[model samples]
Target chain A: MGVNIKNLSILIAAVALAGAWVGQGQADNEVVFPMPTGPLYVKECGSCHTAYAPGLLPARSWQKMMNELDNHFGEDASLDEPDRLAILRMLTDHAADNPNANMLMRRVAASIPRGAAPQRITETQLFRFQHDEVPAHIWKRAKIGSKANCGACHTRANEGRYPEREVRIPR
Target chain B: MMRLLALLFVMTTPAWATTPQQILDSLVQEARQTQSGFTASVSRGEQFYRAKQTGGKEADSCASCHTDNPKAEGRHIKTHKAIEALAPSANKQRFTDPAQVEKWFRRNCREVLGRVCTPQEKADFTAYVLSVK
Candidate 1:
């Protein structure tokens, strides 16, 4: 009876180890947006909000956004010529259509309509599909004002970490 | 001997950090070159800071995002991002860098006033912001 109990305990331990390994493997497969390392990009783009990962949008979307910085969304976000071109280059190099772009970026590229150009990431179908479970009322909470404020719940969002295990929705 | 020591102390003191006054002076100088009699008035600056216009699609005036008080921390009306106080007294790093100051002025003026801010307007705005102690 004692031998059977010991064997059962060993089996449970092995199963737990295998589960942990599988979990780690899954995490590795999940594509995280890479954060920009340039100082100009960090200051100019990140000052107002998270310097959104370039891979989130296709090259055409980025080009459209770059060309219209004077009326970027609702506000003027214009940059000097040299700085603008530099940022544009950086953005296009890592855009969703790039061969080196990750799985998440590829998914974003695939989800968009053939001739449609979207300005906001939240407007994308894939982004909506991923966040469909979240209640609409939760976004109005004072601590988490809008969808743009990703750092509100994604603690490591600034660092480009957005794993499901790290999300902490504020009350 | 004591006077000389005091002078030495003053000279040796690190003046590397750009001050709000220095930036304001430079803006005034730049404004003077274009407008012969340009002189920044605190009252005019304050008025500009508060005035609302029908230019922007989202934000109407500087006050819409920066709030009525420059000394107080403001929030981006749409994004809800917290903007640091604009007053030099409230935030030490307010107008330290020339590039940073120019960047905001360029974008914000277009957004709020529907045009690039003139040197005189920039000077007046700086004067008003600095006076918010």
Candidate 2:
């Protein structure tokens, strides 16, 4: 039994090393690119959530959001003419159509269903679809107050939308 | 030795990597939780399943249209195409993973459950699903 355990341990270590090597390879030529930095998307976008998953919408959608800054989620997540222009320039430069968006952005765009209709931040089908799953008692937990209070579980709301792994629903 | 057991424990937990049962419980729980901010209400998952749309060209709960697997023969009442069931693996083209699980909890909880879900309802519904097989 002792010999078997030792052999198994060695085998596990070898497999772990191999897995790490493969994981490193998967992190290939992906470049660390930045979003077009014109205004203050970090501060401005947080009104709803962070600047949204850039890939959440197409380049056209981002333009629409930026254009209608006055009515952004009923707020003004916009910048001044100079600031807005710089932001726009930055956005357009790094638009979903642009190659600079990260692989995550590009992957999200590709995953969108072919017939999916154009969706806003609030009116998205996926958003609607997901909200349907939660039960009520889960929310009444002393820790949670409201549905829109995404920050209850999603620690990253102040930073942006919930990352899948980051959400830890209250017990 | 303790670390090994801890790792094994996490790996075996259903919540970490959910199955169909866990998903269903989460749904049921969301329906039962009490929330103040909802635009609507749903006390039962079945009731939620039978809800009706408001201010639209037609009115029906999700069950009104998606009676069966959409890919088979269930067609949309409006579009006249095959209706799609909410099954994740069934519609890989739609929900790739559990991340969408939380996403829907937020979106559908409002649409059908009429609010955010409670964790208890999630557990019950998840239990209900485990019993399916």
* Best-performing candidate as measured by lDDT: 1
- For candidate 2, give the lDDT of residue B82: 32
Expressed as tens digits, the lDDT of each residue in B1-133 for candidate 1 is 9999999987886544678889999999999999988889999999888988776557788898889999888877777667788898998878988778998988888787888899998999999999887
Highest DockQ model number: 1
* Reference-based lDDT, each prediction: 0.83, 0.50
lDDT of 2 by residue, A1-171 (tens): 567988999999999999998875554323222443433664344333434444445566667667887554443344557666666655566554466565645654565555553546445554555566778888666556445455567665544345556778878
True interface contacts retained by model 2? 0.00
Task: Extract clashing residue pairs from model 1.
Answer: none
Give me the overall lDDT of model 1: 0.83
Interface RMSD of each: 1.4, 15.9
User: TM-score for every candidate vs. truth?
Assistant: 0.78, 0.37
Q: Candidate 1: how many backbone clashes?
A: 0
